[model samples]
Target chain A: MNDSTQTAVQHRDYAGAKLGMWLFLFTEILLFGGLFLVYSVYRSMYPEDFHEAAAGLSVVLGTVNTVILLTSSLTMALAISALQRGNTRQSVLLQGATIVLGLVFLVNKYFEWSGHIHEGIFPNAPELLARSHGQVQFYGLYYVMTGLHGLHVVAGLALIGIMLSLTIRQRITREDNGKLENAGLYWHLVDLIWIYLFPLFYLIT
Target chain B: MNEQDNHIVTTKTFAAVWIALLMLTAITVSVAKMHLGAFSAFTAIAIASAKAGLVLWYFMHLKYEKRLLKFLLLVPILTLAVIIGLTFVDVWYR
Candidate 1:
């Protein structure tokens, strides 16, 4: 490669990359925001049924998952900082911690969902279908919103895994840490969405 | 690249923010148990917004970002507000 071409390849625009990630995050926020709007309208229409259905959700499980996700977000931030400081081992370890916590959150979600399903409270289940219209809509929105958030959690895990591998290979280092920072941004966005979701769905009652 | 120019957020800052977030979470959950009538939802949402703001500013490092990115971030939030506001008006009338 020519000298100029080599220099171009070596240069990394951290700001531009982060700007792109922020724009993508905007779309994500709006995507979830639309669902929240629907939730608000329906909630106003059926406040009582919403409360009744929300009560069926386990506060303990929801609270535990909230704390787990929050801690994972913290670990994600720490991992990026560790990477920036040239401590690849510590960075990889923190990222690993984040992934494990993400898995724990998912496991808790499984138990929570199973508990509801066992009681026949799932969307389109006979028991749920037999409920009042408001009740049915409540469960419907609950599943869709939380299920989508869970998908984001899984995606964050995959991104962090890639980051861990790259850190181990020394491909992402103190000099060029744009990818790690962007991954942290994405993970934080996941946590941000859940921050609102927890209140809107679980605590609003 | 100038490594010194890059803002290295300390462990202390992250820990303090995390603790604050957890405390906010606890407050929201406890307040939910109260019979505050219409204020309950508003209070919970307000607290949640505060938590989201802290994550965006500190954890996401928006505070350290340039003005252009900060303005870009604000645009979407404003747009969302308008959309939600108009929707609320429609819902309120019906």
Candidate 2:
């Protein structure tokens, strides 16, 4: 949200910016949509193996991370709300909280992945490969889906981090904060993906 | 964008939605513990869909956005649904 003249009243198309963000989110849904389609097909093809494989996952960790992501989405949304009300400092603080929550999610993911790896259950490991084909495919989708999701978390953190700085510098003021709003949209989309991931991967067992 | 562009959703509303989302999470987790047979997956997905709706409507401000955006969102959702529906039909019959 930069203006060339710093005093030319700063033209901004708020609706257009938000529309662009939503368009980006649609592509994201389809990107993961293809994966979800793959997941559902495999799941139907090998229901028993899928169920057994999913049971190996730690529901506790999954639930914890789900909570973390959901709360972070709230913070991200609230940060935008705070800015809309001209509460710049509060908005910045909420953005910081969102970043912290996002990092916490990744930390939980690290421990979860490490735990699986320690058990020789990672994708393509000899232990995983020796299993039924259905089980193999299950973990394959698991890693690919969650790994991709974790990357989005990292990108979202960087986006919010930038928005946080801009908000602090008053570059994203109450009147023109489309950048912050777009960042918030991206963060929420990440959370939305996790919502489906948690149940399909962790809870379905 | 006009003055109404500054639609400030109250913090209380946000807090309420947060509580609702958390409650739905808890419900989904608890539901998974039950032996609903094939319905287990279906139920869990239904609950998760509800949670997603809350995030989209409130957190993402889709509820407050223009009508065109609502239609824009319908595009991807419908496309995904059609893809999944056709694939399942083919798989189920074969």
Candidate 3:
């Protein structure tokens, strides 16, 4: 919303933050969308290879991460709401909870990627775990896409931390909480990306 | 906030969404396991697109966003979808 058009503009820092995040998310989707387009085209050309590669991924880990990220999203939404309701204590608490959950996702990713690496399943790692060259390429793209996404998660965590500090320092109030909402929005986009990535990368067909 | 305005989500809503997502996950995985002949590609991506829509609606809060913001967010996806369609039209058919 423009400056004059908003009634609570002065206190709605989160609104502009979310708008910027949505724009950034647009670029990110373009980046990942390009890779996905490549994957989709290749999946059409060589279906079995993609299926076999996807099958090797750990479903349990992916599901766990999904739940974790989803929980974080819930906590994040609640965090902003807490501030809105003028409950700073609950706001800080929920925000901290959200950060921890976000870390859990990264830690899970670390082990998950390392498992593939240990098995010599990475892109440049020549010998696959009894798979094809295309299969290797699939995992390679999976790593690239997810790994980059993991980095974003970390960056998002940093942003969350900043927002958390603001909350503690009394910079963030219910009236001026657009920053928190924007951070939450970006975080949700990350979760949204993973929801698809989970099925796409871990569930083979 | 009125009692109605304080409409915290009920447990049922969360449970329902989770169940749907898990069911969708199971369906996608099982469908992948089955060799659906030539339709496999179409079916898998179709399922994924549906799941993506679900996530966009609930998790991304598109349903709660400003109408203009919603339109702005969609512009990119629509653009990308068109570009993807054009690429397939030119490359896949020929």
lDDT of each: 0.90, 0.92, 0.76
Q: Write candidate 1's Cα lDDT for A2-85 as tens digits.
A: 333444456667777777899999999999989988999899999999888888888888899899999999999999998888
After the best TM-score superposition of candidate 3, give how far the Cα of residue A177 lies from its true spot, in angstroms.
Answer: 0.4
Candidate 2 CAPRI category = medium
By DockQ, the better pick of 2 and 3 is 2
Candidate 3 off by > 4 Å: A1-17, A129-131, B1-51
Winner of 2 and 3 under TM-score: 2
Per-prediction tally of clashes: 0, 0, 8
The candidate 3 chain A region of ten consecutive residues with least summed lDDT is: A3-12
lDDT of 3 by residue, B25-67 (tens): 6677678668776676567677767766766666566676678
List the candidate 2 regions with Cα displacement exceeding 4 Å. A1-7
Model-by-model DockQ, in order: 0.63, 0.64, 0.35
For candidate 3, write residues A86-156 as lDDT tens digits.
88999899899999999999999989988878988777665774567678678777988898889889988
Better of 1 and 2 by TM-score: 2
Candidate order, lDDT descending: 2, 1, 3
CAPRI verdict (incorrect, acceptable, medium, high) for model 1: medium
lDDT of 3 at A109: 91
Which residue pairs collide, candidate 2?
Answer: none
